[model samples]
Target: MTNTPQPVPASQPIPDSTAAMKSAVKWGVMGLIALAVVGALLAGLFAGKEGVYGALIGAAVGGGFILFTALGVLLTAKLPALTAGAVLLGTWLLKMILAMVVLFVLSDMDFYNKTALVLVIIMSLVVVLGAETYGVLGTKTPYVDPTPSSNVDDDE
Candidate 1:
């Protein structure tokens, strides 16, 4: 019955900055993995022998970039969860568009590489579905409040 406000833990907020960043990093990592697999397949199927090495390098570099960018976006307190989600989602959509463009362009040239195209297509599907899955699961993660006497305690 006391109107006294209790200290709340930092985790329960929907716009939790930390969770937002963590989710960003996680989704980004997953996307990078899908891309890496596709890239490796592309190299093995199209780039000849040296392409394998190049593909590995590409995977590492690409994954690193995504990870860092995601981390950066999430690390800042100024960015909200919606913003983080938008950035990550936007990047993924843009990449898919670019891949489609490449596929169409290459197909026009009569130089269609089935392996590469299929890899891209599959990767895109996985990324989209995985993102959705993460979206559902990410929100389910429990946020713990450090302060037990916070307003949140009243709700419980």
Candidate 2:
């Protein structure tokens, strides 16, 4: 038997990112929540009630931003590429505005520890983003072939 090169065929539709996004969202959420618990505990230990409050708020804001982005992509997966892109962009802008408003409002409040809040928020972002990346990279996808349809007899 001789081995010959097979002619490549036309490309196919791009694979949907829903599965990957789902994986990302699921793991990212778990990681963020885990961080929230740990951060809250540590902060509470160090600074008391104010620390606890700060940790919770910070975790929500930092992790929530990225999680919402994943959700936006997952939700818009069925739409046309351009449409989905537009929707995601809009969602991102909205999230940014809301985050700014929330932070601005929180700035004046003296109920929470600012240092704890900032640290936990930054940590939450790093942990959740790492988890999301792991989920996406670890996902299993079916192989894609660009070869023409099979020419062998089915019943041979």
Candidate 3:
């Protein structure tokens, strides 16, 4: 008797988008915390308590923005594909405007070192973004076939 080849599974286990987003947020937060600690330490070493406070403030602001964006993405994940893009674009624009306003307000404050705050904010943003990118790219996912298969062979 001749043996027939077994059919391969239609799809392999793939990483879920929601799960990937969650992982990214978790890692991003951790990275932000680490960056904040480092920034605080550096500030304290160079400019004492004031600098440390500035660094902490900057880290807080940056972390807030990152978390806010992440939450928006998670919330929009359930939207229809066509609408999701437009909603995400709108969310991004709003976030940018809000962040700019907050930064402008913070810049006017005299209590903290502006230089330290600005530097930490920039650095923390980079860290969080990088972490999120890494998380998304690192996840394993399977490609789906768009076309359905028919039991009958095309060739007769």
Please provide, for model 1 over 6-79, each residue's C-alpha lDDT reduced to its tens digit, 9 standing for 90 to 100.
Answer: 55466855455356456656675677676767676667777564454455544543345345445555554467
C-alpha TM-score for every candidate: 0.40, 0.82, 0.76
Stretches of candidate 1 above 4 Å error?
1-15, 76-156
Candidate 2 local lDDT, residue 2: 40
lDDT of 3 by residue, 1-156 (tens): 443444456695445658778877888888889999999999989878889999998898887788778877878898998787888788788878988898888776787888889899999989999988887777665455434456746555
> Which regions of candidate 2 fall more than 4 Å away from where they truly are?
1-17, 145-156
RMSD of each: 7.6, 6.7, 4.6
lDDT of each: 0.55, 0.89, 0.81
Predicted structure with the largest lDDT when compared to the true one: 2
lDDT (Cα) of model 3: 0.81
lDDT of 2 at 140: 68
Clashes of 2: 0
Is 2 or 3 the stronger prediction by TM-score? 2
Clashes of 3: 0
Clashing pairs in 3: none
Candidate 2, 72-148: lDDT as tens digits: 98899899999999999999999999899999999999999998899998998899999999989987654555454
